[model samples]
Target: MNATQEKHIAVVGGTFDPIHYGHINLGRAALSALHLDEVWFMPSGSNNYRSDMGIRAEKHHREAMVKMAIAGEERFAFSDWECAQPGSTYTSRTFAQLNATFPEVTWYYVVGADTLHSLKYWEEPELICNSVVLLAAGRGEQVTSGELQATAQTLRTNYGADIRFIPWEDMPVSSTQVRARYREGSFAREDLPPGVYDYMTSHHLYQSLEWLSDQEILDRCDATPEERGYYERLATMLTPRRLRHCLGVMHMAMLLADGYRNVSMEQARLAGLLHDCGRTENNALNALGHAPAGAQVARRLFGVKDESVLSAIRWHTTGRPGMTELEKVIFVADYIEPFRGHMLHLDKARRIAYTDLNQAVTFMGESTVRYLESRGEDIDPITLETVNYYRGLLKKQPIPGQYQ
Candidate 1:
């Protein structure tokens, strides 16, 4: 094949303990600049250069994250060549193995300018230099264009290495920053690839829940002193079991609020904490009217003034039609909190609540109707109204104002 038709592959290798946008950008730039057919991500199994950086994630987890980060890009692929090796892997050895495996394909190695400057210290620098073309992307302000050119000329003169520079805007993201965010329980979905973030949440990586204690949950709430005083007073009125349930609901409500833009975390916390304020037998609130009673108690006792929070408290048990976002949050939290005992379809309800709030609310309403019917109990009129309203929403039909 002529040069135009020849297979050109760029290899991008790194520790990639947790791949971020910087890594993805480097690969994409290499593909565009070098006219390469594909970019392969090689996550290092072990790095001798950074052995002092503390414990790294297992090879499988690192590989999984890389796979997720690169997904949906047909030109991007990954290799387990370094990860399959038993001990420390050198760049020279990796280059040699790749050359042997794809001798007909022209190879280019993508690296940051910082790594290019440190090339002399890596194992068998001359072999690494000769193995493939080096494409160095500019890093932060530390590496200037003049400095990169000078260094590239030196390597070309001394080691016969073909080096090219690619202009790259510095992205303020690193695996260390990602890990720190995960540990602090403040990691946002935008910081990482969608699939990678989903995987991290599912696998519970990077101490995701280490900050989920009762105090930690409360700390995340942006509550004023008066609101906290209300929380303290409400806690004293419940039995131990009921108190635990309330805390769990508060935690779940905060989590749900994080996924939606309109829902406020503080509103969710206050509404969740007081949703069951009237559940006490001594308080004279029953199953049929506990929600309305709780709303009154929230207004009279805690001085809650927000209509949304009061409406959420009033309708959490038997949801009304056309509920607000805060109302939906409390309603879903009460059903799916971690402390809630086993209930049919609860797991699916929790998943739906996080993924799609409206769907979860409708599911809960329909499921409750079915459950009450199975038990031969009278279905509450408000719940029937809620079920009809959301079902109408799902079907894109206009609901009557009476239900609203």
Candidate 2:
């Protein structure tokens, strides 16, 4: 086969709700093994197999994410033809349409080994198998050579399918795992393409209260049923004004985290959102601080088990000495969020946040002290300790860990 003798096109189709690295690896593997000129990512609009799955995003969002995911890959392109169709999407129908459009090229369907096993059950399975050469890739620890050989032999004998198993190291990533982590407030940007991850975060996709209706919100939250219940309760518990403030804090924390590499944006957002969970009419002036109270509520009500996230929420309002990067981000974001409304030097504090995290923390702590003194309110000992500690750092001196 000369380099330009045949026009070989590989087609990788999936729901791709938020395409991860694993999907990209599979397409790359197929392209290399089959010598395909390009890989077309076909994101199905309404998959009959996945129709019962509740976590699917809308067609436009999925399509957008897919585009962002494959932006820089020269050989990768996406088609909206399947998504534009109404009703359940069948692979056979897509293959028919693709063949009609590009009759000169040889189409290879790239899929996982699991999908290969279930291909016979798809609508008009014979038509699908005969239309394109099936290129099945293995998932980590799931597909075996013996099983793959048996399945391919059966398919070839039964339906005259041109099946080939492209062997490569298995990738453990999956969209389900990504969605689960997002709901648990632990999604890492490394699991996805950088552009796709940024798009999801900036748009607040897969978060609680971002969708219409409680059920839709719960569905998109990507948490377990029990965790979803807790989110619902929290939504009702906080006043609308307070909830808006919490959201603002979350966004601010994420923005600040970009400058501080030690802190995770996801953890910062979670801490900022739950920082005021304990503030209510009953506990507005309680002797027990809202920070600690919010930590307790987060543990008991929201099932938060991450120690760093809990600690960040626990000390967001009153900064403790020797705080972690995430703690500093949440503490600063809570003070400087846009909705905080009318504070002296707030603009300076916001500017310092991106330039120097330590300075921002020190500024917020000192401002809090001065504000409390002016109002004749009691000063928290820990707040003073934090201010002094950062001041010591600014002066290049060691301060004893008195508040730890």
**lDDT values for all models:** 0.76, 0.74
Writing each residue's lDDT as its tens digit, candidate 2 over 242-325 gives 766776676567556533445775677678777888886567655338889999989998878999999998888788889999
Cα displacement (angstroms), candidate 1, residue 32, comes to: 18
Candidate number with greatest TM-score: 1
Task: Compare the candidates by lDDT and give the number of the best one.
Answer: 1
Q: Pairing residues by index, what is the TM-score of model 1?
A: 0.51
Candidate 2 vs. true structure, TM-score: 0.50
The digit string of per-residue lDDT tens for model 1 on 1-404 reads 46655688888898886899999999988877777889999987562212211133435557789998898987999887786663357889899888888777878999987787799999998999999999888754545567777888899999999888776765788899888888678888888875878766654555422234544445434346766676678768878677667776776776566445357777887888888988875866567678898889889977889998999999998888889989998998888876666778987776677557788889998888888789988778788788888988898453343434
Pairs in clash, predicted candidate 2: none
TM-score of each: 0.51, 0.50
After superposition, which runs of candidate 1 have C-alpha atoms over 4 Å from their true positions?
Answer: 1-213, 220-224, 396-404
